[model samples]
Structure formats: structure tokens, C-alpha cells
Target: MSFTGSLVLSGIGGLVYKYGGQQSERETEVPVGFQSLTIGFFQARIRVFRTRLETLSRTFWRQLVETSGYKYPIRGVSEMFRSGAYFFPWARAFAFYLVLYLTIAFIYFCTILPVYLALLAFLGPIGFAIAYLHFLLHSNMLTMMVMRFTQLHNSLFDLALVHNGKEIFVKTAIQSPTLPKRYYVPLNTYYFWLNYLPWRIFIFGFGFTVLIVLLLISFIPIIGPFIFNALISPFIARIYFSRFLRLKKLDNKQRNDEFYFNFGTYVSFGFVAGQLEILPFVSGLIYSSNSVGGGLFAIKALDSEHAAAPSGATAAATAAVSGSQARQDTTVA
Candidate 1:
């Protein structure tokens, strides 16, 4: 696989690791595309589930307040849950946008490109290179956005766990809510260079060198191309994965563990998906869809639990305060 392809595959694996365990085992057999839709459906379900959880959380909070004689504030918790819920739909929309854009870009490149080049006088290597660069830049932007969305999702998970008195696995191996700042700052800095002038010149020069090497090695038969790629692929993937691990909040030790674990899982899943992709009917679709659906279900459940606990506590406190005030007024009168 290409460097970008590996990164994308690894990302999917990481997401599954983060959320897939919560889904029913039966639901995990479907393919990714189907699973993606199921995830969207589950996302909708989570919205509803979140509402119910919010109600329950408020109630639980009220009870806690009464029992402990503590103040439970509903406003802040309600607002936070509301914001978190908004993120789900926003993420869904963003995912759709990426899918749509990729489809359009593919069509333009494959279908329109040849025709446009034939008709235009200026269609040449320079034009093609520019177009390719544009695609690469756009892909990078999409990747950054996806990372940000995942971070937001993780934050929501943390809030939910904290609210519910659940212990979050906060060790190095886990993606913590605390890691985005460290990764994003550096990533954004790199991204700025990636998009700017001198860097693009450097990339073009590097790409030309690589192209020349590939052309030279093409004379050495099929094995030469494979050998070149094999040498380069691991280095590229390692750098990308390292950045990804940092972004996902894994420290050095944790990242090393997850790198091996996720790399193995990714290869396994990719093999299965690739095989299914070549199959006659809906086999691949079924597999991918199920995984995505299960993941969505799991995330929804976690968020529901988190939102419920806090809301429940707040509700209990409100009830207690109202009761206390009523009794005090009666006694005074």
C-alpha cells in the first residue's frame, strides 16, 4: 500500500480500538461502507440516547445533592452536554463532506482530466503536477479535520466517564483528553510549512528525485519497484504513525505498545477488507459496515452513561432545594 493508504488504514484501526468493543459481537461482522451508514444511524440514535441520559443525569445529580447536602448545578452540565451533542451531528456532516469531495475529485481526475488535457494547449506535466499537489494539500486538510473531530469525541468520552464516577483508563497506552494540545500545535506548524512557498518547492524537488529513481529502477524488472517501495514505506508510515499516536494522546511508551498492536490489527483488517473488496457481491460492504456500526453504538453508550450521571445528580439537588425552601416558608409563616 501507499504511505497515505497506510495512514488511513491505521486511523480506522485506531478508531475501532477506541470504540469497537462496546458494540454487540453480532454487529461487528458487517462491512465498512454499510457499517459507516450504520454508524451514522447510530449517531442519530446517540442523540436521542443523550437526551435520555441528560434527563437521568439531572435526576441523579438531584439525588446526590439531597443525600450529601451539596449544591448541584444543572446549567453548566446541561450546556456542556448540549455542546457535546452538537459535535456529533457536526462530525457526521463533516464526514459526509469528505466523502462527497473525494467522489467529485475522483471523477474529475479520472474522467474529465484526459478530455481537458486534449482540448487545452497548456495541459502538461506542470499542470498535472499542480493538480496533484492540490489534491495532496486537500487530503492533508481533511486528515487534520478528522483528527480534530476524533479529539472532540474523546473529550466527550472523558466528560461522560468523569460524570458517571467511572475510572477512565488514563495510562500512556490510552488516548487521553490531555494530548491534543501537544500534537496539534506541532502539526499545525508543520502544516503551515506544508502549504507555503519554500516547502512546496522543496517537496517538488524531492518528488522529482523520487520519480527519477523510480524511472531508473524500472529497467531492473518488477522486483526493483517493489524493493524501492519496501525500503521507503516503513519510514514514511513510522513518521506518520508517530505523529498520529502523539495526536491521540499516547506518550512514548504507550505509543510504542499501541504502534505494534494497531499495526498488526490494521494489517489483518486490511487484508480481509482487500479480499472482500474483490468479492462478487456485498461481502466487503457487510464487514466494514458492521465494524463502523458497532463502534458508533459503543460510543453512544459511553456518552449516554456520562451525560446521565451528572444530570441525575443535578436533578436530585433541585428537588431537595425546592422541598427545603417549601418547609422553611411553611415554618416561618
Candidate 2:
């Protein structure tokens, strides 16, 4: 895996530096053919994955271990049961949905268990592969449900962020109710669907194609799933924190730039979040937890950036203080 990752990074870097550098020049100089275009597309994708893999630094791994984000899953589960007027109603709704979801899943699994076992029997030694594929199928099939769950709990996520911020003392994260609100629509609203359906269709169509490719990749041995996870990390990250990103008022272009600029950090964060989300029975709960976790990450990230980057006012204030100190020292001398 290391060798493959390194080789991919090295090769893609060179290819991008060569063919990717001057797109207009290349388009003019060499007639763009289907073959070249296809290669270029794949090259771009490779570069993206390579950049993500390269971003998994040792410090990131350490932070992953230390960060409270990983605990938010259990925290989310606990929050669901916590006693509060605000939480009780939502908790009951979640409980009802969970019961219904699990009941249906139980029946479905009972119906499919014999067939699954037969396949396992036939596959024998490769039963693990079958099981893995089944898990992936189940995980990917829940994408729509995941999105719906996210929509349902958007307000909860916002509140969780506020709570998390208070715990960590990040003032910006503790935003006010009077914050200039963006126009909002409920997920189930007709207007929302009307505006979103076209985009949803495109996303689903593209996602189905990607799913087929991932299924093929899963046929590979151990490293296949790792590679698959790595490739999808960025998308997973964005989806998990889509609401938080919007809350931060990052327009599409700004979000894209942020993702590219901090590609490594996002990938590392997403990879961990994705792993937790791959579990079968608890994935829905993890979805809720992921909102909180993603929020915590965003808070810490913004705080770190804020600390590292002095604001215009902060810089001016610091400069003024320094100049005053210099004058006082000169007078004393």
C-alpha cells in the first residue's frame, strides 16, 4: 500500500506538472483526443486521491486519537436519551424511526439470511469477501437515508456545536440566535424539493456510477477497501459537515478552495468519520454523532486558523503596541 501510494503520488505529480500545467497551450498545440481527455480525467482523480493520502500525517493521527470528535458517537447516543424538553421530543421521534428501521431490517435480513448463507457456503473461503461486499452494499444503499437523517437533525447539530464550543471556549462557535439567517426550507418541503430535484438527480446518477467502480475495487484483497475509503474521504467529509460549512457562510467556491487548501486535514478527519459510519446497525446513530463530531472539528479548525492568522485589527493593534514599547524603551535608555 505504501509503495503504491508513493508511486501514485510521484507519477501523478509529474503528469500533472507536465500535461496539467498549461491546459490552454496543450489544447492549442495538440489536438485534444478522447484518449488524452480520458487520461487527463483519471490523472486529476489520481492527484486528488494522492493528495488525500499524503495528508494523513502522524500529527493528524495523534490528533484523531486525542480529539473529542471520535467520542461524539457515544455522546450522540447519550444525548438522544438525555432528559430535556428540547431533546425529549426529538429523541422520541428518533426512537420511533429507529424501531421502524430496525424492524424492517430484521425482516429483510431474516428473508435474505438463507440466501446469504448459501452464497457463503458456495464461496467457502471467499465468504469473507462476500460478507465485506454485503456490508459495502448495505452502507452505500443507506446514502439517501443518511442524507435524510442529516436533514432531520440539522438543528440538533447546530445546538450541539454551541454546546461543544462552550466546552472548548471557542467564542465564534457559540453563535447567537440573531445571526443573520440564510433563507431556509425544510427538507420535506415542496419548494425545497422543487429547487433540489434536478441537482439530486445528477448527484444520484453520478453516485451510482461511482458505486459500480467501488464495487469492482472491493473485489481486490485487503488494500481495496482502504483505497476505496481514501478515495471517498473528501466526499464523506463534505457531506457530513455540509450544514456546518453552510453555517460558516462558505459559498460553493470558498468551500471548494478550503477543501483543496486543507485537503490533507479534511481527508484525515473524514477517514476517521467514515470508518465509524461504516458500521451496519449503528450507522444511523453515527450519522447523528457525526454531525456533532464534524461540528467540533470545524470549531477547532476555525479556532486554529484564527489563532494562526492575525486579523487586520489584531495585526494593527500588535504593531501599535510594539511601536509604543519601542518608544518607551528608547526614552528609558
Candidate 3:
């Protein structure tokens, strides 16, 4: 009935659906008596599941290190601070939101001060604790909204990818008229508001509601919040890949499938990114840096995938990039 419980149940169901459904066909092929078949089926399932678990664990650690998600956020923040252009956007975003938050907080404080005093008089220190928690929750809600809507950090993410040699790849993809249309999904304001915005709102609402429940369960301790973040981290991690996914031109279903296929990597990346995000007061700055880290991770991961891709596919990608370069040169000539 709890948020954690629901997550656990869903995770179990997902694993079963992902792996268990194959048993019927495999079981039919075994060609054995009922008793032996049952035993062999259980044995095969256990072995297969164990192998998958081990693979996922290894993938998690490898991705975590490769992505450098733990330190990228810090690096991103430092770079933003050092660069006037990057720093300006972050400052502007922070200042704008801070002023807005203060204006609303002032109004709320004025209206709630009398109620707080009455509660304190009747409930002693408990009322003060309740009020403090209320304020913390309110601030968190504002912080999340700002983080989601402010597009400032995404540029930082792109900058990171460009620095790591994705510029040519992305540029080619953009220029190549022959590239798959999916790879060139136009991301204008209309798309953002009409398509991306609504989905994000739904996800944010559901995720934050679960988080609030978890936080309230152990408001004074770190345990509940930690668990909540870890459980919800894969979703958070995917946000870091939004730009990269757009480049690949995956739809919602394809994107979700991609994440599910690389569940370990996503979870590990999200866990580290989520930890960085949990820092109070400076989350906007941290989030910006995390974007840089995500870019670095994505580049590394994609490079690895490129190496592993079939020779024909690699050749096609190369042709796309080369063709784009040729077209550019022709235009200049």
C-alpha cells in the first residue's frame, strides 16, 4: 500500500513479464515427463535469472564509472561559474526563481502566521515541527518546478557533448538529408508544449507525490528519502539523456524500451545523479553540472556502442557524416 511497496511489486512484475513469459515456448521444447519438466523449468529459470542479475550488476558498475555521473555535476557547476555565458543563464534562472519564490513565500507567510501561532499555542513544539516540515515541502515543490521548466541546463549538456567529439556526429545528422527522419525529430516550442510538456508534468506529478509520501514517513531522518530516490532514479536518469534520445529520434515507446534494455546502466547513472540533486539550496547549479556529466556519459556509452555495432551499420553512419561534410563543402564552393 506504501509507495515503496508498490514499486517493489511493479519491479517484480516487470522482471517476470520480461523473462518468465519465454518459459512456455522453451518448456514445450524440453521434451520430458511432467515431473522432470517442472524441475528442469525451475532450474533453468533460476539459472537464467541469476545470470541476468549478475550481468545487470556488472553493467551497473561499469556504466557508473564510465558515465562519471557522481562527479560530472560538480564539474558542470564549476565550468558554468567560470564561463560568463553559461554563468549568466544560471544566475538569471536562479535570480528569477528566487524572487518569485520569495514573493509567494511572503504572501503565504503573512496568511499562515496567525494559524501557526494558534497551533503552537495549542500543540507546543509539535506545531512548530509541523510548520517547519510544511515550509520544507513547499520549498521542495518550488525547486522541482523550476528545475523542470528552466531550459538553461540543457545547453550545458550540449556543450559537454560537443566538447567530447559528438559535434561532428550531431552536426552530420542535422545536415544529412538522407539520414532517417527519426533522427531529426524537430524540437521546437510547439513540440515541447504540446508533446513533451504534458508527459513530463504527469511523470513529475506522480514521482513527486510518491516522494512526498516517503519524505513524510520519516521526515526527520534520511532513510526514507534515500530509498525513494534510489527507487525512482532510473526515471531521473533518463531526463539526463533527453537530448541524446532526441538525436536518435526515438519515440516514447522506443525510449522506454531503450532504458529497459539498459536498465542497470540507467539505474546506476540515475542513482548518482539523484544523490547530487538531493543537495539543498544549490540544486539548480548541481542539476546543470549533472547535465554535463550526463553528456560525457552518453558520449562514452555511444562510442562504445559504435565500436560494437555491425560493420554495415557503422559504415552507414560514416557515410551519413561524410555525405553531410561533402554537401557543406559543395555549398561553400
Candidate 4:
């Protein structure tokens, strides 16, 4: 993983050194493949799913090496907090929440009631601003953390894991039972309401569906959570890849898997990850690592069903062969 991460970084760094100079205007185009209309939407989506499965199996060798999914999320988050890059997002978010709260309070009490009612007119601007601030926190750290871990995930295969931040379009982990000692954040203790007080009330909140999904399946039986977990694992992986990881979205599956899939893993990874999201300054830091966790989950899920990757084939070269094989196998019964 280290070797592959280094190689991916080195390759990107070399590109940056060559063509990555800072410029005033910034724009990059989304790849045009997935957005195009297809003849059999279901069939096209199935083929794409097979391709993605093959890609991860062929590419995510490093992830395959791990016996536990909890390791990377733990370490990545620890590094984030230990270094203190995780706090900025929450601080910004809570600050906005506070200011907005106070402004409304003042309008309700301190100012004329009619004017306060009129001030309700500002909800559009205020709402947009609030959502924007929350969105702001998860993304910057997210893009870097995701791409790096992606390289790490695919390290053994060494496919060209290069990601241009341009592919980071609008969004999007599961771990086992581990009970920790009662704990709390150091400085930002007050911000915990982002998780507890507001259930989808906050403009920046990201875990509503996880709770819904978990509840939806809770009556089914013991395996409900795990059942939903496996069912939604690919969606979770793609979210990690595209949203927090800021990579391009993997498959065009809008036509299928809607009920079980989400760009945000809300209950599985998002719920677990959000435990730290209310921790003010470190929220984004901890949240950004969720992608790796999600990737590892997806890698484990897929590899369990597929054969081993070929030895000594550079993944970049063999991916075509692998994809072709997957397509040919489409007709297999």
C-alpha cells in the first residue's frame, strides 16, 4: 500500500510539477461516458456494474491484504485529529448555526415582530449559505484523503489511480461492534447537537438515511443490518470514491438499485463516521477518512465473490482484458 500510494502520489506530483500551476480560472470536464443515454438502461447498468466489480478486484489489491476494515478509518482519523486538520469544518458549521440561531432569536424577540416575520424572507439566502458552509467542511480534506487511500486500496495492482480534482462531482463505511469508553471532544463539546439535537435539521447534516434504512430493515431479523450493508455496499463504495474521495462516480445505475443505494452511506459508514462529525474542528478530518473505510468494505465484499487477480500483469494493461472477459461472461448462465 505504501509503495503504491507513493507511486500514485509521485505520478500526480510529476503531473502537477509539469501542468499543475495555479491559475485564476479553474475548470475541468466530467468524462462524457456515463451520462449518455443507452439502449437497455438495465443491461447497460449491469455491464457497468460488472466492469466496476472487475476494476476493484483487479485494482484494489492492497485492500484485499487487510483482514479488518476498521484499521484504516481508525488510523486515518487519528492522524487527522492528532495533526488537527479535522476541526476547521465543524467550527465553520457551528459558527454559522450559532449566528443564524441568534439572528433569528433577535428577530423574534429583540426586533419588531412584523419585521422578524418579514425577515423570514431571507430563508433562501440563509439556507443556501448554511448548506454551503456545511458542504465546504467535508470536501477539501475529503478529496485528498480519498484519492490517497484509493491509491493505497489499489496499490498492489498499480493501475493509473491518478485523479484530477475536476472529477469530484457532488456526493456522497461500515465497521464492527466495538464499544469505546465514554468519550467527548476536547474543545468543541458544544457542537454535538449536529448529531443529537437535529435529525436532518442541520443544513450540513449527512446521516439521515442510515437511520431510516437501519430502521426500515430492523424488523426483518438478525441479519437485517448486515443484509442492508452488503446490499448497499457498492453504493457506499461509489460514494466514497466519488463524493468524499472526490473521484468520478463509478457506474450509471440511476435506473436500478435506487431503493438500496445512496451516494451517502447515511446509516452504515455515514452514521459511524458522523459520531465524530459533531466534534467541531476535527469533523471534516475524521469524516474525510470514511471513504477509505468504504472502499475497504466494497473491496472485501467484491473480492469474496471473484477469483484472484492475475500475477505480474500491470493492472493498467490487464484492465482492458479483464473488462473484455467480464463482457464476454455477460451471457453466462
Candidate 5:
């Protein structure tokens, strides 16, 4: 059977098992007639199962939004840019450059591919295969570079926040004493690219298949096309986050917080990318830079420990004075 068919059958079996089991239990406990008991139990189970499925669906969406990638809203991006935040403008500019480069590359590919195919007949299939492989390698390298850029942005912000004495209250904040500089390089350029070979191929194949399916289905009327295409946004976000999470620089807590906090932003960015593929570069740069600025703010807050300490010190002095007064009373008595 097809994968979708199998999934449907599994779902059906699960429902049957749940209802049948519940009916059996009810029949034994409730002193009602077996027929009535069975019917009531089945109805109750269906209601419960439906409620559970709905809840699960909602939770999945929430997770997709919350734990995806660079979670900053566009308004946050604008605010950071207006404030002359050091990271924001650079990130935005970088994003634009990256998008421009990608556009040019696509144009080149479209023009060159037909000529290459025609020439390959005179040349050999092996030469064409090698060229195609090289292209794939470069594409993977680009993806890795993007991931590194994200990591660097996050790291810079994290460091800035810590330095500033901010009470950075992300759920995960275990500090990394050292950062691996090599991990930030593009995949093809990395020394250990082979290590990720299996997973990379699997991910690429899955993504390619999904994209084809979405493109095919996206021509349908009303909700059909939009809904299928919408799936691409979350998938992109998921892949980006998965890459970000694999970075060695972040501690577990920081990674978790980053994943959860940035999911919505990632999803939004993905949706934007699907409609306008060039947007990812610009969005990535802006979001990463904003995060860096926020991190700096956090560091500044952390650094201002003097403000926090004075309140505690003052309270301690007050307690000491009260203690002295009590001692004097005791001595006098």
C-alpha cells in the first residue's frame, strides 16, 4: 500500500482499538444491557478521540511556530533598524546581497542548463553528471553557510547580553566556553562534510519530493493550492532550525530556547521565501542581526549588576541596624 494509505489504515485501527476497549470496560462496570453499554462506550470514545486529535493538531501548529527559527517579527526588524542598531543594517544589506546573487545564479542556470544538455550529447553523460554533482555540492555549501551565519548572529547577541549584565532569561542559557569556528563554513568547504553525507542526502531527497508534490498540487482551486504551498513554509523553517540546532556553539538550554522562540519568525520567513525565494537571504540577515542587537541589550542588562546589588545591600544594612538596636535593649535590661 502507499504511504498515505498506510497512515490512514493505522489511524483507523487506532480509533477502533480505542472504542472497542472502552466499550468492553463500560460493559463490565455499568450494569446496563451490553448492547446499550457498547453503543454509549463507542460514542464516548469517538468524542474523546476527536478531541484528542484536534488538540494534537493545534499543538503541532504551535510547535511549528514557536521552535522554528529567527523568531523576530518584521516590526522588531524595523525598530532595530531605526534605532541604528549595529547589527541590523549590516544584516539587512547582507541579506539583499545574498538574494541578488541567488537571482543571478538562477538566471545563469536557466540559460546554461539547456546548452549544457545539448553539448552533453556530443560530450559524455559522465561529464554532465560530474557538473550536476558539483552544482549540488555548491548548493549544499550555500545552505551550510546560511546556517553558520545564523549561528554567528545568535552567538554575538548571546555574548552581548551576557557582557551587559542583563538577566537573560531564555529557558536555555548554559554558556559555551569555546566556539568552533569551522562549523560556520559552508558544507562543501568544511573538513568533515562527509560526516553529514547520509543525513544530507535523505533530507535533500525528502525536500525535493515534497517541493515537486506541492508545485503539482498548488494549481488546484481555492484552498487546495494555498494549503499545500503553505506546508513549504513550515518545512523550510524546520530544516533551518534543525541545522541551527546542530551547531556546537550553543549549549542545550540556549539551543532549546532559540528553537522555541524563533519558530514563528522562521515560519513567517519560510512563507515569505516560498512566495519570494530571494527573501530568505534578506530575512535571515535582518533577523540574525536583530537577535544580535537583542543579545547586546541582554549583555548590557547583565553588566549593570550594580543596580541589582544596591537593593540587597541596603536591606542588609537595615537588618544590621535593627539587630544592633535589639542588642542595646537587651544589655540595658
Candidate 6:
């Protein structure tokens, strides 16, 4: 039997086992008559499932918009360029990326060129394999840049939050112990490139794992690569999403807030983001920005949720700033 055929049969059996087993205790009649099941019970199950589906949809979009790396980056980049301020950070981020790319491409090319020559010398014509390998390696090197620009933009958003139309936020950010001080050079260039290391590992690892799994099931031909990628999309989205959020927290010098995403919200939203990521480059841009959008969205939600109750991160930041001020006062006194 084909893999897909087996999956269909198993899915049916599993569904029956799950729902039937759930109500089995209530219906003690062995080989319980299909006639014994009432419409009301079926309706209740349908309602429960519907509610879950609704929740999943909402949560997925929420996370994608609030914290995703997909859409927010593109939009954020656009906004940054349009504003005409902070031109240096945007330029600096891309420039650093360019430098890193050229450097890596050169090094990898030099190292791998010998390997390529050996393959040609020993094996003779091997189709496009060598060329493809070079391309693949170059792409990998560039992906080392991963979320640099987006993270830089998001970090700026944090400052934007504190400043909120005031000029002193820049001064405060520079002087404040809690808030990250630098804006352009290190902030846009080194910090994000360094920060994205784990994210790069995750994307590469996940992609490689999926490839392995696909190979194992290659004979079955049931689960195509696209279907498989879609299935694992949420997990991938969550990996990047969580990384970006944590980086944001670190940038703000705020403690981690584990409860920010609540129960299934984070994972479900990741799923949605992953699904939307089907369209090649454009989807990626949208999804990245949406991730940041989702994050900003969630922050806004938190602001409302805790309108009466203050934010823990904000409170701690305030305390740190206050302490710094106190120390300065003591020095003067």
C-alpha cells in the first residue's frame, strides 16, 4: 500500500479509536449499537472541535502578526527608509551583511574550489552537482545574516516605545543602564548577526531533518516535500518566533516573560505563519514583518490587559533607571 493510503486508513482508525474510546465508558453495551448514539452527543463533539479550530486560527494569526519574522521586516524596512531618519542603521545593517557575505563567499569558495576541482578531476563530468554545491554553500553563508535587520528594527521599536514622540528617550537610552545604549554600529551589525546564530542552526537543522524524513518515506511517495514542509511549518515558525522575542527582551534588558504567549497561542500562530510562508520570497518578507507585527500586537494587547496592572518588564526597567539616577545623585552629593 502507498504511504498516503496507509496514512488515510490509520487516520480513520485513530479518529474512531479516539472519539469512540472517549464515550465507550458511558455506553456499556458491548459492540454498542450505532443506533445507541444520540444526535446531541455528536453535536457536542462537533461544537468542541469547532471551538478548538476557531481558537487555533486566532492564535496563529495573532502570533504571526505580533512576533513573526516574515512580514514585519519588510514593512519595517520600508518604514525605516521612508522616514529618512536612521538611514545609517539601515545602511549599516545591509552594509555589514554585504561585507560578511563577500568575506564568507571568498573563504568558502577558496576552500571548496579545491574539492570541486578534485570532483571534476577524479569523477569527470558530474552534471550540475558542483555548481549547485557552490550555490548552496553561498546561500548558507548569507543565511548567517538571518534576522539581523529585522531584529535591529525590532530593537529600535523598543526604543521607539520608550521615547514615544519625545527626544529625551534617545538621551535616556544612552544613559540608562537597563536599555541597550548603541543604536547603529554594534546594534545593527554585530549583535544581531551574533544573536541569529541559534536561529540559523534551527532553520538549517529543521530543513535537514525534514529532508531526512522525506527520504525515509521517499518510496511511499505519499507525503510530498511541500506537504511535509507545511506540516512542520509551525514548529519552524515557533523556533524563529521565540528567538526573536527573546532577543527583543534581551535588548530591552528585561527579564523573560514566559507567560506572554499564554497556552497554545504561540505554537498555533506559528502554524499560521508557516502556512502563509508558502509563497517564496514575498511570503518570507511578509511573514517576518508579521512576526514583528504580531509581537507589537501582543505588546499592545498586554498594554490593555494590564492597563490597571503595570508591566513587569516595564517596572523592572524603571527600577533600574531609578537606581542609576540614585547613584548619580549620590555621586553629586
Q: lDDT (CA) for every model shown? A: 0.37, 0.50, 0.55, 0.35, 0.41, 0.40
- Better by lDDT, candidate 5 or 1: 5
Model 6 compared with the native: what TM-score? 0.38
Worst 10 residues of 5 by lDDT: 21-30
Task: Give the better candidate number (4 or 5) by lDDT.
Answer: 5
Q: Which is the leading candidate under lDDT?
A: 3
lDDT of 1 by residue, 1-333 (tens): 122442464467555544332212221122224453345434543554464456555554443233221111122224333444434543553464455346544654565345434544376776566445444433332233233223323433333334444344323325443442211112233223332234347756996588557534522322333343333332223332333344344333344334343343323332332222222123212222222222232334346556766567888998589545433221111
Compared with the true structure, model 5 gives a TM-score of 0.35
True-vs-predicted CA distance for residue 63, candidate 5, Å: 6.1
Residue 233 alpha-carbon offset, candidate 3, angstroms: 1.7
Off by over 4 Å in 6: 1-70, 113-174, 178-256, 259-333
* Deviation in Å, model 4, residue 161 alpha carbon: 14
| Candidate 1 local Cα displacement, residue 75, angstroms | 37
Across 16-100, the per-residue lDDT of candidate 3 in tens digits comes to 4223312111111222455533454345445545655676676766765665555654566665666664665566656654664
Candidate 6 to native Cα RMSD, angstroms: 19.4
Once model 1 is optimally superposed onto the true structure by TM-score, how far is the C-alpha of residue 244 displaced, in angstroms? 10
Q: What TM-score would candidate 2 get against the native?
A: 0.50
By TM-score, how accurate is candidate 3? 0.55
**Residue 70 CA displacement from its true place in model 5, Å:** 11
Candidates in order, TM-scores: namely: 0.26, 0.50, 0.55, 0.30, 0.35, 0.38
State the lDDT at 2 in candidate 2. Answer: 21
In candidate 3, what residue range of length 10 has the lowest lDDT sum? Answer: 21-30
